[model samples]
Target: MTTETEAISDDALADVAYLSRSRNRITILEALRSGPHPSGRLEERTQASRSTLERILTELEERGWAERSPDGYVTTPVGERVIGEFRPVVTAMGSIRTLGEAVAWLPDEELSIGLHHFDDATVRRTTPNSPMAEATYLLELMREASVFRTLTYIAPPLSLLQSMRDSVVEGRMTATNVLTDDLVGYLRERPEQTPYWREYVEAGARIYCYRGHIPCNVFVVDETVLIANNDPDSGHPCEFIETTDETVRSWGRELIETYRRNSERLTPETFTEESRMSAEHTS
Candidate 1:
């Protein structure tokens, strides 16, 4: 890739710009990738006027992107490679658009978002009637999984925690949480959750407290990964992007465990001391 990047010539940029100026030209070139097609077939596919089609084909042949074969117009090796690489950029645009505001909160510096990983993902957002839509969807995934882990800077929905606890109590699931110092403080202040936390621990759930690097909330349930963000206005779980893509899931697991390995394991008995250390670290 380094060699290829260095080898890219000024003429290649000009070729790209030239093809980009006319959508019809790109359409015709992409169509020829499969096999040879007559000029009339290209016209029907591109829906361009005869004059426009003829001019575009002439330009393509001149630029070495397409050629007139005995069968018809066919894509050359140069055209094939150009479109093969260019197609991903086009796909990335659609993925970016589909992600919408979720893109803003993603930890892009650490997690390189790639094409196709989230293309077929299930994206959930807080709706007017269901503001906890994102969190609820996570609970749904938890209900079906045998193991789940999370790395978060803020507390998860209490209901989701309760569901995790109950499932773990039945000896049907394993749960682990890698929390930031901020979240430890969040939980420390929630007195109502103290006893529940103890019960959650007794039920075989694991908790570890780490200081930082938890930019966005991550939930990995069995083979699925959910990346979530809060609604800026409501401060509630807003968007949840979930996928079972192996690359993303592998990355997610690595991220969670990497934090956990660096964290201090917490038990019910040590919660207060952990909170105190977290407070001092923050102060």
Candidate 2:
């Protein structure tokens, strides 16, 4: 059996030292995340006793996680990088574990950058008895927002459409939506729903259809999104995340904008032609 000392390389061991799992040490490092701070301030911020603070600070300085300058103690570049990478994982993992396989709805790259946003967000799990819970919660989120944006794999149901129409008519909200190419085609084929979408267009909601890229089911209400997996045939419980984290919301908006920029405007005249063009290109 490899001893702990023999198993870890010198460089790896050094990193471990910097990120020592000691609660007090970790607290001190987190307290310095805002900027440099004097010893007194660090003690107060971390709520670590003077002796504990002193030891951790000394260790941090030795490990290059901190530096004592004329003004105060500051986190070093290496320390910043470690914290930046580490904290997000720890924070996001809480949500990811709850989300399970449903977390794959967001692109891997976007998820990495925005995971921290959902650190304090809530997750709602849906069962067969409450199949419409996700949509209901999404509508409530929309109702709470002054401005909303969304990327959807499925078309809005009549109930959601009516609610959105009421919100728009009352001047309560404005929205932009991006739908997958296939959904747009599906809507075009369904005559009953055509008027609903047309009414949305008349209410001043902007709509676009993305041809490529994987479909995402996300609803962004101001700084939060109702996010869930794109599974339509799964019998397992569906997981949804509702978050107001600025980073995640910003990324969600940017994601929609990227599709919007590359997508076709969903006007009645362009619907058929654009759908055909998208199908040909995708094929």
The C-alpha TM-scores of every prediction are: 0.71, 0.78
What TM-score does model 1 achieve against the real structure? 0.71
Off by over 4 Å in 2: 1-10, 17-20, 33-38, 70-72, 109-114, 235-239, 268-283
- On residues 1-283, what C-alpha lDDT tens digit does candidate 2 reach at each position? 8997788799876665656566676667777766888999987877888898888888888878889878788899887777777676666777677656656666665554655556667777777798878777767766767887888777676677777777776778897988887887777766666666766777777889888764567778776777765667654323567777777777788877877898877764533545556755876
lDDT of 1 by residue, 1-283 (tens): 4698789898878876876677887788899999999999988998999999999888888878889899999999998888777767766677778887676656776686575566666677777798766666677878888998988876666787788878888888998999887777678767666556667788888989997666778888898888877444646564778778898888888888988999988787644545656756888
State residue 179's C-alpha deviation in candidate 2, in Å: 1.7
lDDT of 1 at 141: 76
Worst 10 residues of 2 by lDDT: 268-277
- Compute the lDDT of residue 185 as modeled in candidate 2: 74
Per-candidate Cα lDDT values, in order, are 0.79, 0.73
The segments of candidate 1 whose C-alpha lies over 4 angstroms from its true place after superposition are: 1-14, 17-81, 230-234, 272-283
